[model samples]
Target: MHFLRYQWEPYLSYGQLFEFEKNKVVYHQGEAGRGIYYLKNGEIKVTLLSDKGDERIINMVPPGMLFGEHGIHGEPYLTSGTTTCPSLVYYFSDDVIATICRKHPEAAGIYTDSLIYKFRTLAEIIAHLDSPVEQQMAFYLLKLVQENGNASMNQTAFAKYIGTSRITVNKIIQKWKQKGYIELHKREIIIMNFDKIRAIASNPHMD
Candidate 1:
């Protein structure tokens, strides 16, 4: 949080900002913005749309995490991010960002680190593409369970994260459910078996 405050205080000086409601688009995939975001509250889903109009969730944006970092790449915005709840976002223009970097080179490194980790995650996905969908889904469910504090996990959200449709997720969830591996009620998904799930995720190869 301290790192964010260090990076954020400078942007506040510019005073350009916007707020968004649940499911509202903060920016589209190809729009331009000069500043990064400091998420004060709520959550956002970073996503991309297929040519066929399907949504692919890339990541969940939690509080205190930065988004719209394509400013570093000189693009307007790389992908669209929408809120899951009402959100407060600070928008800083390019001029404002430049001023901040001038004063704090370390802040630039922090931003670069964030982007690099994303790229590394993409690399890992490519390497794991050959893995079975069941393992892939299991791996992702475990991640959500951890990230969301094992709270309610919506099947649609899981499907989006796995880059598949909800129906596919439902089918896979059904298999797990029958095996007493999970419990699903409405939008809630509860993992009942951790060892088996982890073993599936730990498979050295994507079978």
Candidate 2:
């Protein structure tokens, strides 16, 4: 959960800062990769649009993360990025980023590390595709807590993010509530038994 915070302000001086309202689309799939973005604050959802117009939630980018790196290669963006809340994002043109990296080679490591982390996460997701729903939900809930300090996503959104039906998510959540593993608030879910949740997440086969 720890992120390396590079001294990027000086190198990113040429970058433009833009504020986006909640649910605002920063970029769309198939758009020319103009530049990568640095998220100064707030959350962003990266999604992929299928040929049949089906949209899948890829991952959520938290503050201080670098996204839209596909723009660096000058190809079309494979996924669309949208703000989940009011957000401050810095847009760095591809050429400018290249120049900065050329002049400051160390800066390139930051992006490299970020990209590696993203790829690792994607791999983990793929590996867990056939995992029990409870285990996947537990893992995702822990991830949300780590990133946002709580599980704030609603059941519908949570289900979509985990690639499961809302009914399935609701059933597991209700069971957790009855078992005193979590507490459901008006808008958030609080983990009451972190150890138990972690155990389930790590070993789904355990009772």
Candidate 3:
């Protein structure tokens, strides 16, 4: 999805700036949407809570992206958000956002575009749910590369993101390492052979 490049920070002077450490909860699912969040730096994970009280990672908000946007329409938040790393976020109340949109007008278009981008991403995720794990992993790794320039998630988190076990993710990583497709460091996986990885990612029947 294309990231919108609107100058949101300057307009957010009325908003509050907050610093969050890694793993801090930004908002909980089912909570009244108090405001929207603009990520100035670091990553945030959006998770959905199932009826059974299980949590599933729904999306990752990259730096410069917005989260908790449902509040702008007076809707309760559908998902919980948490910081994946130390982060700086600007929180804009619904009234402030509405006022800004009313005054600037163009800001409304930017918000609409951001919502469109998010829906498109959600559609893609839904479409890929039944695909092979290998293909899903490839798409996920590519997504990570686009967002952070490397696979920044550890095996457990990656497994949760991909709906697999940590052991399975570790085995897959080991296989990729043996094939010289990736290099696993302490907490990151570097793509060593992009073409080969791309090939695997594109081929649904690849073993």
What TM-score does each of the candidates earn? Answer: 0.77, 0.88, 0.89
RMSD, every candidate, angstroms: 3.7, 2.2, 2.0
Q: How does candidate 3 score on lDDT?
A: 0.79
Runs in model 3 deviating more than 4 A are 51-53
lDDT per residue as tens, model 3, 1-207:
435632576576767899999999998888888978888988899877768775657677877777877655567787788999999998988788888888889877777787776667667777776777778887888887876567777888887777778898888889889989899889988989888778877885654
Query: For candidate 2, lDDT tens digit of each residue in 1-207?
Result: 456443455565767999999999998889889988888888888877757776766678877777887767678887889998999999988788888899889888887887776667667776776888899999888987886677877898888767879899999999989999999998699999999899989997763
Order of the predicted models by lDDT, top scorer first: 2, 3, 1
lDDT of 1 at 87: 91
Worst 10 residues of 2 by lDDT: 1-10
Q: Candidate 2, overall lDDT?
A: 0.82
Off by over 4 Å in 2: 5-10, 50-54
**Lowest summed-lDDT stretch of 10 residues in model 1?**
1-10
After superposition of all CA atoms, the RMSD between model 2 and the true structure is 2.2
By TM-score, the best candidate is 3
Clashing pairs in 2: none
Better of 2 and 3 by lDDT: 2
